[model samples]
Target: MEFDHVLSVRCSVRRYTEEPVSEEDIQKIVKAGEEVPVGHFDFKNYAIAAITDKKVLRLLAEENQALSGRGDPIYGAPLLLLIMNTPEAREDSIKLNAGIMAENMHLKAVDLGLGSICIYSFIRTLNREEGYGKYFQALHLPEGLKPAMAVAVGHTPMVQRERRFVARIPTFRIDGKE
Candidate 1:
């Protein structure tokens, strides 16, 4: 399919079927993420935590709810791709790099006839939430790495709402007149 068509086909799928995502597809998703552009310098700093355990998902949901006051429902997807930003890079670079990786994963999932949704609403509260940060620490993941973003991925279980399009207008005024 054309890239434009693929872009249109992709959407944030909030409802996932019970069908377990295949390991092959999972590998593709992860490889796609790894393929996206990280900055030219110090690009080897990003990592991920791919999770499918329902119990841990439940725990994460509760923590997210407690921190943000609204449950960040994962929609029971079989995988959660957690982007980690290692401290080796500058802070801004880390976020931008992670975003590139995420877009790659999203588009790759779309290309593979899969679905995904990015969750970014509760990060400010997450760092200070009781036991949340500690959980990461206890995991003995590399030091100086932090969770930047997460995406849930799975098969579509139902049809979503009608497609909505919003056109983009140039923000700058031409010669400060137009």
Candidate 2:
């Protein structure tokens, strides 16, 4: 698919079907993320945990509901890609790098005809010093890597494409010359 078409059709999918995304597509998505540009020279600045186990997804959804009253925080997607980085890294750098990785995965998902939505509730729920933080132990991310964000992926029954709007155009006149 063309890059513009991919961006035009990409949307946040909140519901998914029972079908699971293929491992090949999953690897491609992860590969896209891995290929994202790094902020600090080393491209290994982030880690990705691809959770496909129903038990783990259910646990995360239940815990997220209990914490934020948002039921099905992961939208029942069959796969959850948790992006992480060490807490010692600069906040801006970590967030920027994670966003780049996630956007890459998101675009890849779109290209593969899979549904995906970037989720934050999981990270928020797991960041606590008490309560749901226990679930973080199960992730066992390398030493200091902290959960930054999550991307839920699976097959969707319907594909929605965003409508293009041309009501406005860019005005690059900074010198007041109209």
Candidate 3:
């Protein structure tokens, strides 16, 4: 699918089916984000964790559920991808890079006939409360990699599309020339 079409329709989907994302689709989704132009696409720029484990999801969801009061299992998502950056990066560069990658991944997933959502909550707290900070290092990421954002992917109850505007903003003549 073309990039424009994907962007036009892609939005945060709240609900998903019981199905799981195929390995091929997961690769494609991550590949699109990896293609995003980041300053350090090198070894330590960002780490993408595509989690298929419910136990891990539940652990993270504990954070969100406490904050939002909704424990829908992250919208029943099968794949939870978290993007991380290290403290060595530019201030907030970790989150900045993850956001760019998140957008790219959202559009790509839409093009692949799937849906994705960007989620952020309780991760930092979890890192502090728990010892999950080591999770990034366990992935072999350079020490100090901080998780910035997460995206949930799966088949949704509805395929979102760009809404057709029913009305347009009225144009006004500002200058006498008009």
Deviating ranges (above 4 Å) for candidate 3: 40-43, 124-128, 132-143, 165-178
**Local accuracy of candidate 2 as per-residue lDDT tens digits, 1-178:** 8888888889899989989889899999999888888876655557898889887788787777777677888788999998888666667688788888898999999999899998776687667745336556666556777788779999999866766956587676478765
The numbered model that scores best in lDDT is: 2
Query: How does each model score on lDDT?
Result: 0.74, 0.81, 0.74
TM-score per model over all chains: 0.82, 0.88, 0.78
RMSD of 1: 3.3
- Name the best candidate (by TM-score): 2
Total backbone collisions, model 3: 0
- Give candidate 2's TM-score: 0.88
* C-alpha lDDT of residue 24 in model 3: 99
Candidate 2 or 3, higher lDDT? 2
Of candidates 2 and 1, the better by lDDT: 2
Q: Tell me the TM-score of model 1.
A: 0.82
Task: List model 3 lDDT by residue over 23-52, tens digit each.
Answer: 999999999888888865543657788888
